[model samples]
Every structure is written in C-alpha cells, then in structure tokens.
Target: MTQLKNLLGFLWYVAHKFQRDRCMQSASSLTTTTLFALVPLVTISINLFSLFPEFVKVSQAVRNFLLANMLPDSASRIIGVYMNQFSSHASQLTYAGLALLVITVFSLVITVDHTFNAIWGTAPRRSWPSRLLIYAVLILVGPLLLGLGLWGTSLVVSTSMGWAGEGAQATHSALKVLSLLILASGLALAYYKVPGRPVKGRHALLGGALAALVFELMKNGFTLFITHFSTYTLVYGAFAAFPIFLLWIHLS
Candidate 1:
C-alpha cells in the first residue's frame, strides 16, 4: 500500500515536471522539425541499407513493422507512399544538396538536444565536434540497430511458430511486446544519457517504461479516433495524411 502511494506520488511529480517544462510546445517544435527532416532521414537510412546488402531485407521488414504497428491504417498507406517518393528524390541529390540534407537533419537533432536540456535545466555539455560525432553515430547507427532488432524478432517468431505451431495471433502478440520493449529501452537510454546531469538507471528505466506505456495508449487512442472519424478526410481530402502524420509526431 505504501509502495503504491509512493508510485502515485512519483507519477504526479513527473506530470508536474512535464507540464512545467512546456513539453507540449517542445513536441510541437519537434513535429515541425521532423516534417523538414523526415525525407533526409529516410534517405540516409535507405543509403545505409544500400551499402549493406545483407541488411536490405531487414530494412524492408523494419518499414513493414513500423507501418503495421506504429501507424493508423488510413495514415500508414499514404505516409508510406509519400516517404518512398521523398526518399527517391532525396537519393538523387548532388553533393551540395546532400550537405543541405545533412544540415536539415542536424537541425532536428539540435532541437531535440535543446528540448532535453530545457527539461533537465542544464546547458549543453558537449563541444560542437563531440556533438557532431555523437549525432552522426546516432543517425547512422540507430536505424541499423532497429533493423537488426526486427530481423532478430522475426527469426525468433519464425522458429517459435515452427516449434510450437503457434498461430498468427501469437506472432502478432510477440511482435507487439517486442515493439513495446524496444520503445521503452530506447526511451530509457535517452532519459539516462541525454541530460547533462547524472540520472539513476533504475529511475530512468521506470520513467521510460511509464512513458512508453502512455505513448502506446496514446497511439491506440489516436488510431481509434482516426478510424471512426472521417472528418479529417472530408476536410483535408488527399492532404489529410500530412496533418495526421504531423499530429502523431507531436503526440509521440
């Protein structure tokens, strides 16, 4: 009973902190920045996969996984088509154009760094060179890690299905769990590492898990709203996907 009270207290405190930090504004800013950076990021990911032929299948799987799990049925198809178009155009960029794309991507990272710093009440700790290196590593390695995770999860699911004769429902449940865990783990790492001050790992983990749970709930609620409501489709027509995508990014 005491532990439950403590947990409630902690949650209330975190909610207060989040409100005080103007996280909604930060999220709005992130959504705007993401709109500009999405194509470049996708292009980069596509280029990375191209360089590693063995991982091409993993990349495709990751895309499919995200579309199926993270997005609403209405938004996923339209967004996927837009992403493919943007990435194709981005891939043909000249060196100067590529540099601009990199800059645009860096702007998103800088915004994120500032947002985290604001939430933590800390100044930037890393120098520009170090920050650049870290950002580059994150941009290049993050998708690869996600692809590998998807690949591994697929392998496990396949093996399990073969051994246990599990049905599609079991496979989907496993994938959902994997997605939740991966989201939570990534959030935990960011919570631990992004702040200038030291954060306890357990605290970060707890916060991350809670946040991931909330995000999953939000995603489901948003999907349900979109599924039932055709207002956006009626109002925006073909461009409805853009706003829905932006709203999802902000909520996320």
Candidate 2:
C-alpha cells in the first residue's frame, strides 16, 4: 500500500510537470512535423532496405507489423496505400531532391530533440556536427536492427506455432504482446537518451511502461470511438482517414 501510494504520487508529479511543459502543444507541433516528414522518412528506410535484396522480406514484415500495431484497420489501409505510393515516387528523386527529403526528415528529428530538451529543462548538449552524425547513424542503423528483430520474432513465432499447433488467434495475441513490449522499449530508450541530464534507468523504464500502457488504452478507446461514431466518416467521406490519423498522432 505504501509503495502504491508512492507510485501514484510520482505519477501525479510527472503529470504536473508534463502539463507545465506544455506537452500537448508539443505533440500538436510534432503531429504537423510528422505529417510533412512521414513520406520522406519512410522513403529513406525503404531505400536503405532496398540496397540489400535478402532483407526485402524483413522490410515488408516490418511495414506490416507497424500498420497492424500502430494504426486502426481502416486508417492503416488508407495510409499504407498512400505511403507506399509516396515512398515509391520519393525513391526516384535526384541528388538535390533526396537532400531535401533528408532535410525534411531531419527537421522532424530536431523538433523532437528540442521538445525533449525543453521538457528536461536543459539546453542542447550536443554540437550540430555530433547531432548530425548521431541522426545519420540512427537513420542508417535503426531500421536494419528493427528489421532483423522482427524477422527473428517471426521465425520464433512460426516455430512456436508449429511446435504447439496453435491457431492464428494465438499468433495474433503473441504479436500484440510483442508490439507492446517493443513500444515500451522504444519509449524508454527515448526517455533515457534524449534528455541532456542523466536519468535513472529504472525510472525511465517505469515512465516508458506507464506511457505505453496509456497509449495502448488510448489506441483502443480511439478505435472504439471511431468504430461506433460515424460522424467523421459522414463528414469527410473517403478522406476521413487523414483527419483521424492526424488526431491520433496529436493524441499520441
């Protein structure tokens, strides 16, 4: 009971800090930046994987996993189609065009970095050259690691299903758990690394787990609201997904 009280107190304190930091406003700005950068970022990741023929399946699996876990069914379908089309065109860009693509993507990252530092009440700790190097390395390496992880996960799931003769439902449940864990880990990494000051790992993990839980609940609630309420669909018709996606990004 004492531990529970302490946990609640800590969470309340964090909530107040987030409010004071204007995180909602930050999220809104991030949503706008993300909307502009989404295609360029996806194009870069896709192009990176395209250099290696063997990882083609891995890239496809990663895309499917993201769509399945991150967005609602209808929104995911619409966005996936548009994203693929945009990325295809983006991949054909010339040197100058590709530089612009990188810049667009970098702008989003810089926004996130600034927001994080503001929340932490710290100035930027890294020089521009160092930051650029870090960003370039992340862009080059992050997707490769993610693809390998997902590929390994798929192999493990297949082996597990084969051994146990589990049905599709079990596989899906496993994937859902995997997605949650991955989200939590990513959040924790961000919380730990983005801040200029040192943060305790356990505290960061706690915050990440809490945030991930809230995010999962928000996703389900939002999906339910969209499923039951046809107001957006009625108003926007076929273009409802864009607004819904924007709303989700802001809320997230």
Candidate 3:
C-alpha cells in the first residue's frame, strides 16, 4: 500500500512538472509553424519518395496508415482533399520557392529544438552549422527510416494474412501496438537528442512512454469529441480543418 502510494505521488509530481513546462504554449507555437511549413514539408517528402520507384507504394501505404490513425474518418476525407490540392502544385514551384520552403521547414525544426530545450531546462544551444547539419539529417533520414519500417510491417501483415487466413484482424491489432511502440521510441530519441544536452536514457524513455500514452488517448478522445460534440464541423464546414488542427495541437 505504501509502495502504491509512493508510485502515485511520483506520477502526480511528473504530471505537475509537465504542466509547469508550458506544454500548451509550446504545442501552440509548433502548430502555427507547422501550418506554414506543412506544404513544403509534404512537397519535399513526396518528391524524395518519388525518386525511388519502390518507395512509391510504401509511401502511399505509410500515408494511409497515418491518416487513418491521426484523424477520424469524416475529418480524414476533408484533410485529404486539401493535401491533394497542395501536392498538385508542389512540383511546379521554382528552385527559389523550394529554397524558401526548406527554410520554413527549418524554422519548425528550430522551434522544436527550443521547445525541447525548455522542457529539459538546457542552455547554450548548438551552433548554426551543427544545428543545420542535425536538422538536415532528421529531415532527410527520418522519413526514409519510417517508410522502411512501415513497408516491412505491411509486408509482414500481408504474409501473415496469406498463411493464417484469419490473422488480418490480429495483424491489425499487432500493428497498432507496434505503432505505439515506434511512437514511444521516436519520442524517446527526440527527448534525448533535441535538447542539445546529455539526457539520461531512462529519463528520456520515461518521457517517451508518457508522451506515447498521451498521444494515443488524445487521438481517441479527439475523435470521439469531434464525432459527437464538435460545433466546428457545423459552423466552419469546409474550414473545420483550421479549428480541428489547432485544437489537436493545443492538446498535444
């Protein structure tokens, strides 16, 4: 009983610490920067995937998985239309335009760096060259790694379905679990690396686990709220994406 009480007290303290870190403020700042950066980021990502013929299918699969996980079914269609519209024009942008796009993407990266620094109470940020190099690696390498992982997972699911016949549902459940674990791992890495300071692996992992759990709850809770109680849909209609996106980010 005493151990249980101690654990509960510790959890409450961590929760309070997270609140004190001003998560809403950071999340709002990210949301704003991300909105500006979204077009360029998606454009660049799709362009990169287009370079490899094998990645085409994987990219689409990964995209579908993300949309399904991130938004409710009704909201997904609306968001998809907007994404398609932007992507149609992405290829026509000039080199100068693309450069600006890269800058906007980097702006979001810098914001993330600052937010992590604040969370960890770190100081003396990395120099510009080092920062740019690290951000470049994250921008270029991160998606490819994620794509490969999704491709491999899809392949396994498909193979399992062929052999077991009744494993499709089970495979889906397994994939959801895998996705949570991956999210946690990625968050752990970010918590460890983004502050530009040494962070304990255990501390990073704990933060990651907490973030992953909150993320899952956020998705489900948002979907439920939007489906049942959202006035944004009725009031904003096609513009519903704006408020929905903001609300989601604020909650993050």
Return the candidate ranking by lDDT, descending.
2, 1, 3
Worst 10 residues of 2 by lDDT: 162-171
Best by TM-score: 2
Stretches of model 2 off by over 4 angstroms after superposition:
1-12, 163-167
Write out the backbone clash pairs for model 3: none
For candidate 2, what is the lDDT?
A: 0.83
Candidate 2 lDDT, 1-252, residue by residue in tens? 999999999999989998999999999899999988876686577567866889887788777877888777766787688778877686578899888878999999999999999999998778999998988877777777776777777677777665555745566777788889888998999899888999899999998999889988988988899989979888899888888888888987
What would the TM-scores of all predictions be? 0.88, 0.90, 0.87
How high is the lDDT of residue 242 in model 1?
80
Q: In model 1, which runs have C-alpha deviations exceeding 4 angstroms?
A: 1-15, 163-168
State the lDDT at 187 in candidate 1: 90
- Please, what are the lDDT tens digits per residue for candidate 3 over residues 46-74? 56776789888767755666667655565
Arranged by TM-score, best first: 2, 1, 3
lDDT of 3: 0.78
RMSD of each: 2.6, 2.4, 2.5
Tell me the TM-score of model 1: 0.88
Tens-digit lDDT track of model 1 for 103-198: 999999889989998999998788889999998998888878887888787777777664555745676787889888988998999889888888
